[model samples]
Target: MKKIPVMAAALSAALLSVVMLTTFSGCAKKPKLYLYNWTYYTPDSVLRQFEKENNCEIIYDTFASNEELYAKLLSGGTGYDLVFPSGDYVSIMIKQNMLEKIDKSKLSNLVNIDPMVLQKATYDPKMEYSVPYYFGAAGIAVNTARVPQYEKSWSIFGRSDLQGKMTMLDDMREVLGDALVHLGYSVNTANPAEIAAARDLVNSAWKPNLIKFDAEAFGKGFADEDFWVVQGYAEVVYEEISEEQKKNTAFFIPPEGGPAYIDSMCLLKGAKNVDLAYKFIDFIHRPEIYAEFTDYFGFPATANIPARQLKKVTPYYQAEELTNVELKDDMGENLTLYDDAWLTIRVGD
Candidate 1:
């Protein structure tokens, strides 16, 4: 009877020890990080480098548009530790208190960022809440062989002769914002009347000239020669052109002014691993890493000095042309006006 009782006690103690050990192991495991960003925005090699350096597992997710990312985050389908959103959307998120203020002490490499980028962001006045990743201009890319008079402006897309030979981005904000700017109105205008006028201009431009309104098709279409002129993001079109076709393809920043956007890294309020997130941001901001990104992706870096040095290797680089660039500012309540105008343009009202 004594032996039986002792055996039961030993078994109970062993099970308890096993449970305690398992609990401790689980607690010791590294935290997982989730990142939500644009499609093909970051190279996998960069991600692998980050993962190897940080000793953590990373889960990356991609979205096609900023609106799509907003919708997904709002819907609460998944939780993300970090996200890369455009300056306007970052401003919107900050206004909504969706982002957490970053501690500058955590990001030492932030000092390496370009002074121009730091000064120009309208969303984060001091860049307190966001770190700029890349900057790009919405411009026209023309197959010079197909369109002889392509050097003009957004008016080239309005030409009747270019009908069915032009492609525009499907993004409402970019498409409508540029149209608003081209029509001599503010891209961030809030007035209903101004928005309506811009809508009318875009609708009229679309009626005769649009081959299609697409987000991803412009680059491939330009390469295939299915479209001679495309309203394209600088990076996408630049990446899509072949070495030979690249000679024929030229990007034009509309003389009337067009929308420029900065994609930035931000932390969400409910982020679980804030320390790791900052470390990742710092890793990305390293000059060599930033240069690698710009060289491979064809997007201009906010780390302008390092990017400028890297650009010297490419014959296509033109620093003078890119110097006078601008950035998109928050529209606040005017976002509604722009959306309504976009709807009107698309629905014919």
Candidate 2:
């Protein structure tokens, strides 16, 4: 009788131990991801699809600007599995050691990315830490009907007649760089004298003619004909313009040159769910998903052959036209010169 009781107690204890182990294992297997990205950048349906297929919940967050996003990630100590940053910011983040080294072995769909984009990017020489998300050019959008006189050059922003009827980007680097390029200097010039000269040009131009120096509001102003000419992103203007207005609203690549930027996705260094992040990235790289993104976002994707085929079905695809688009190289420490020039332009002297 004593032996039987002891044997029964042991069996019960073993079963209890098994149950605990199984419960803990199940908890350990659930995957969760956190993503930080730009506002209105990704389609919610795509995110839903990812969640359904992977059985992982993705907490998506947005920032209005790259600088804001950088500041938050750097100072907040918030853990994000994935983030999207512009090409130049990627270089900055990598230098700060904030990004994780991507494991190519885990990313089978990485082959979908264009070799050219990977080769040309200055931030991730070998694309070690980031994947290209979108590419766009900065240019002038003018309402020809309002202006009557079409001006194609960058100098049009300085026209005296257009006083209080023009808007320029509030972005320090882009606006300053455009001014520098207008003066025939390198956009990435580090020479203090050169930057100062660029500042003078922009300051002198700002005087009574400037309507507002802004980024976000400028695009809407242009579309509404509140401004005759505005300096802004090509993609945003392209999407905002009505088919009728698009004919009258001309988009130009300044003869003097303008900024070209690439937005890319990167993994944070201390991310707890790195594997899940890679899985999510690979899922987006699939042809169908890429198509959906390009259709809604109206920017060029970096995926190579698949993107080419996907473009066929969507009006947003511009594969042939994208060939001529340029990309901004890392300006290195010269970025400070651009920022300083911007301040000088806005505040004078």
Q: How well does candidate 2 score on lDDT at residue 244? A: 91
Question: Model 1, range 1-349, lDDT digits (tens) per residue?
Answer: 4455888989999999999999988757967779999998888888888888877888899998788988988888457888999988898899888899989888888777887766668678577889888766777888887876655577776788888988888878778777677777876677788778778877876646888788777888888889888887766777778889887877867667767777899998889888989988988888778877776766555455665565423523343344545566776665777777777767766
TM accuracy, model 1: 0.84
Model 2, residue 258: displacement in angstroms? 1.9
Ten-residue segment with the worst summed lDDT in candidate 2? 312-321
Candidate 1 lDDT score relative to the true structure: 0.77
Candidate 2 positional error at 338, Å? 3.0
Q: Model-by-model lDDT, in order?
A: 0.77, 0.77
